[model samples]
Target: MKTYRSLALIIILSLSVNALFAQNKPSHTDSLMKAGIALTDAGKFAEAVAIYDEVLKASPDSKPVLYEKAITLNIMGKHDDAIIILEKLLTSISTPNVYAALGDAYDMKGDFDKATSYYTKGISLWPKDRNLWLNLSVSYSRQKKYPQAQAAAAEAIKADPRHARSYQNYAVAAYLQGKNAEALLGLSNYLMFGSNNQSLGACNVIKSILYAKPNTNADPVAKLEQETIAGAVTVATAGKTGLAPIDSLVLQLTASYKAIQSQENQFGSSFFARYFGDFFGAIATTNYMDTYTRFIAVSLSPQDNIAWLKAHNDDVKAFNIWLNTQKRQTE
Candidate 1:
């Protein structure tokens, strides 16, 4: 599942949790499951476990109950318990989704080998389940096994050409494998079909490619603007684009300009909210906001856009360096 989908499901589970449990004087198995789901959503895993136990006590081998309990246990960081339940469930209920969930649990436990094992099992059981390959790729990435991760994610793309996570996973793996062109292609695909900001991957690549050159002195503003324009054109073609990062940079730029011009530290987070909120996926912490503001103070100093970019070029360089060293997601 996409991270956002998991978040959305948690929201839906929270809303129906109490209402589902309150009906008919206490609960049915469905009601109890809803209660467990709700508790899990609320981060009340222990309470959810009690509800899950109530169902299991009545029907010791209830697959649904077992699965729910396993998920809740994993949520509580109790991976071994969850894995045990998942293993038991496998005997009576063997399916792709189940195995995916099991693989996720194992991954969380830092057992990538076992995680990929279950993911492969899931794939064998349901070859068309594109998600299985994606999950397997993620496991491989976590282990720093870039080549294997790339192969699995590529399989996911072949299985379902439009699968966004497949591209994202593949891009990360390719980058780790030092296949810059492959990474760029996958990142472009992600921008078009997955996350709107391909810059999360692309800017770093540009910076790396630029930085790796000998005796190079690329104009910072021109380089950034050029890369930004190219990335924007690539991403803004359809419903697949997002405008948060630049929108965020603009707000920061303005705030720093105000502070520098007025010499009066007057702007508040409210200004950031007005612009940054429009682009960022979530509200940033005060510390992160401060860092951006500080960046602006340094970057916008000369009032010459070129000077500003040159002064703060290090931030871009740093982010690029970080991305370069990031291990593949599945390994």
Candidate 2:
């Protein structure tokens, strides 16, 4: 579960144990709270709820105890119960602080309109808060309210011009609204926001997700191959053994791939020369020069590179030949 975010709630959470002991004379409350927090951290939320309830009953008007109980209830998937406590807090407190908590609570209940109302209340009262609008946008989106979601995302962008998640949400909202080209552009902006220039792993993973959207009907098998190929590219580019001073080795293979994608696009692998529109030069570039000629058996078909690798071979030529021959063909 995405934990609710509100500075006042965080403040309350931090001082909760202190408030328990200081306001109520010495009791077993702090001990219970500590035990409850510890157990909850250990994934024992059910046990934690029992202890939280005892503490709340002992201090009926205590917001700290009530909030902690609500938190544990949420962790236990008791969203309705969590909503009750948070809503009750809202009525009695009626402050920006309470509005923030109520916003989070309603979001958990999936009562997104109320959540948006409360979040709006909090944002209006606390305009300088950097996090408020993003919180509102996410809640709006969970309910599939695209227009409202876009509005909230715009507000978030206005609040934090460079926020990456806001950009991603904007793209999704665009897609939901059937604005595919704009969605792709927004998604590209989201990718450009990242600073993973030196990390091929992140590059490949993001590229894989790019074409996996349902609209494109991209094949999962081909997607997996692209991702795996990218990994090998990353390892090669990062200079991780296999081929020493491997910059040339990596670049030759790099020519096998299209640029890192922000939307679904195909790589022209020799294995699918027909389907992917692969050219002989590109195939030869991808297939290591030495391996292409060497891996061809007497029958002229490429030998299986896996069988060669399994015996602890480092023959780059064989992999290239196998890769080229595997080019896509119509059945």
Candidate 3:
């Protein structure tokens, strides 16, 4: 519930809230909308919807209000109510936000096919909409269609390379398909955007993959990948004593990226070699690894690294500038 509710709120707030205020200006609808948002934030979802109903009674054709009301209904586990409002909105004037909300409502109702249909329709209308692609990928993943999920996630990433959620979805989809290298690369790119509560868990998964032993009976590519990761861990930790955990992680990541770069030509233009290998390989050659390490660590342990980020604002800025100018391989 938290997952879908949170995503629905993002779409609602991003597409509707500010626009509602901007268009309404100093109207009473503005005040009511704020109150409704406040109520929704305070977990008084019923009160919030009632406030939206009040606004709609006065300004009966308020699309933003309608969309937000539907989202709040979703958060309150009223998917049928949300679906009713969203479907009506779609009939009058279709928009990406309405499509996304409708898909989310159906998804929460355990109707993946309906959710996928709405998402696909939204993407067809707005091909550059990363959120639509992301949701479609999630729907496919829920149906255990890993390849389709990965392809949709790749489309999301190509649509908006800077969006963290795109990479996060891509990483999960790739990992589910047993493409660990691609998964690691996707996670690395995702971390570059920022960190959140998900950061620590992602970091732990990364370390586990880096340290896992090679499977003797695996295919050549998988076997080589395992060996590369295992060897990177040894190279990172060898002759090192009392290294801080974050420092150890930085060493291991750099070692792994460098090792992948070394084998880029061996794998020719395979997805991992062409995309993951070339991208992180470029970073391995730069002096930004320390800055990158601390940047991500800020989310891993805020108490320990937040001040470091604050104190080193220039470093963070420089690293971000370098990262943003770099292009990712989307093919």
Worst 10 residues of 1 by lDDT: 263-272
TM-score of 1: 0.54
Query: Worst ten-residue run, lDDT, model 3?
Result: 17-26
Q: Estimate, for each residue in 160-202, the C-alpha lDDT of model 2 and write its tens digit.
A: 6566766667656755654333343345445435333322332
Ranking by lDDT: 3, 1, 2
How do the predictions measure up, each by TM-score? 0.54, 0.47, 0.83
For model 2, name the residue pairs that clash. 270-327, 271-326, 271-327, 271-328, 272-327, 272-328, 291-317
* Collision pairs in model 3: none
TM-score of 3: 0.83
lDDT (10s digit) by residue, model 3, range 174-223: 67655566667778878777777788877777766877777787666656
lDDT score, residue 128, model 3? Answer: 87
Which candidate, 2 or 3, would have the higher TM-score against the true structure?
Answer: 3
Off by over 4 Å in 2: 1-35, 38-42, 94-97, 157-167, 178-331
The whole-model lDDT of each prediction reads 0.56, 0.53, 0.77
